[model samples]
Target: MSEKNREGKRSARERLAVEREKRKAADKRRRALIVGASIVCVLALATVVGVLAANAGKSGKSSASGPATAPSGAVGKDGLAIPVGQDTAKSTLTVWEDFRCPACQAFETAYRPTIRQLADAGQLKVEYHLVTLIDANLRGSGSLRAANAAACAQDVGRFGDYHDVLYQNQPKETQDTFADNDKLIELAGEVDGLNTPTFEKCVKDGTHDSWVQKSNAAFQSGGFSGTPTVLLDGKNIYADQTITPAKLKQMVEAANKS
Candidate 1:
């Protein structure tokens, strides 16, 4: 063949190869776009499904107790608030506690044994009223947040577990180790029955704050200017560390007799 003819043949072959490469590139782009679109749709669907699940969980978690009835500015046990013990006990004891109050902790450690003994024996029922008086000071915000988180857990029927976990992992009442919103949610997550996100939202939204406020009002109305105030059978009971199990037992025994 002539040189020119050979060159012409070579040029035709190169043109065909270039067209094939272009077509291959277009096909690759088309596949990539389809894959990308599928991924996006899947992500969107997952998001919608997750949202529905959360809403369903929220509805399921609604408390049987309605809003608390605060008459005489005192919190009622009817609401989703944690009442400290089962409601059907023969006798009732109400305790106003501050989460960050050192005296409150002391009361728990010292009087808890007797109190639990009474509850276990079916002699008395205890209701812990969370007071926010200390929280008026900036130092008590941690306590307030924890209280709020606990109320959230209560709303979801996980108060007992959340209550135990909070006190168990309670941070020091110092600024450095203070409990924050995140910490409160973490504690809620530690509880077996608590839903972390719902509980967190409840805390963040300040839901059930009125109950806490009512507790504070009760503190004032009951003349308990401080925390760790114990009410035995609707009457205030006060004593120092020397207040013994025997004394508590006598008190309950008398209340029961009457």
Candidate 2:
């Protein structure tokens, strides 16, 4: 072969060799990058899982931390559904209460948090039915007025807040007289976004008087001899001696599993 042709052939072979080496190096770098990225992804996922496990353990040790329950079935005549949680498909609880009853007030204070938690969790539902069984004075015009006021609050989409505030600001049973029209307006004012004029008109006109009667009818049919009778998913929640938060929570938890 000629010297010039041989030199050209050698140059071509050297170039091919260099190109192969460069290709091999690039492949190695890409593989390394892929391997490194996979490792980082795995580590990140493991770290997230570990954090979740730790948080769950800590929550299990605490009293306040737990799974939320549903409360979808708690439909009230006052347009107050369970405010804190979603409701389950089959689980429904009902609360029959008399506004002036002290035991009802106690239940309101005690079981409210658990109810809110479970309701927010979407595991349980709570319905409220007003019973006029506190005193003779509360039965006639007084009970009707209060019950209608609550209904009017419901009309304005402030029933839940109004219900809570009413129980929170309940007067001593010995005070004899319950909330008058002025007091009802004042209590209604405590709830945000409640139209005072409309509520006042409803209360004055007894807009929810029929609702009060229906509640009474339900109270009678449900066999609630008194106020603050709680039914869990249809069955009555027994409060033998004292109605407590723990007991109420237990009731809801039991219902949740079933």
Candidate 3:
């Protein structure tokens, strides 16, 4: 064989090795993401974190106790879910999450792009059920207040952008920074036209607090293990350690094909 051809073969092998290393590195990062705060479950969280007695007292309040004033465009049983994306989408992704949950923030940061992509493409629709797990698990109204603010966003048709903003600005789990209405309203300024007087009033007045409580109740009754309980067409995807943005895209594409 010519020396030049042998050199060419060596170059190709080296390129393949480089690609393999890149894939390995990407997988390692994904593994780290899975083991971080992303996979925390409520069952373990209950023992790991102590809820204040005052917070615990309100954990079981039913919608009948007050009006479950759902936001405009809310759907699902009892209007618990805040829907995003086209209604004509063939696949549905349901997510139960708390704005104050670190695990939820991690999950949102990692897969939000892919989820939004699929939802925007009309292949999938996302139904977000805002829960107050952290408020009940920890010792603050952060979860409740944040969830209420997100609901208020839905009322003004800004839920999608405001929801992402909340996760992006999530504070330390122990700090309870989200419990402040001013902070939540301040964060709303990041999203265009989301920080209006009405939005500010909704945040301060807790307009959707009862709706958030109802959603939390539904999440608890649904037997979900934790915050960011993501399901693709009724199958729990977050519990699957192998799940990645690429895998999620493939799954949604495959669903479209089927």
Q: Residue-wise lDDT of candidate 1 within 23-44, one digit each (tens)? A: 9988676434422222211111
**Native-structure RMSD, model 1:** 26.4
Off by over 4 Å in 2: 1-85, 135-140, 174-179
Clashing pairs in 3: none
Pitting candidate 2 against candidate 3, the one with the higher lDDT is: 3
Q: Output the number of the lDDT-best candidate.
A: 3
lDDT, model 2, position 201: 68
The local lDDT score (0 to 100) that residue 164 gets in candidate 3 is 88
- Cα lDDT of candidate 3 equals 0.79
Model 2, C-alpha of 208: deviation from truth (Å): 0.4
Candidate 3 per-residue C-alpha lDDT over 82-105 given as tens digits, one digit per residue, 9 for 90 to 100: 999999888999998888787887
Off by over 4 Å in 1: 1-81, 138-140, 176-179, 240-242
lDDT of 2 at 87: 44
So what's the TM-score on candidate 1? 0.62
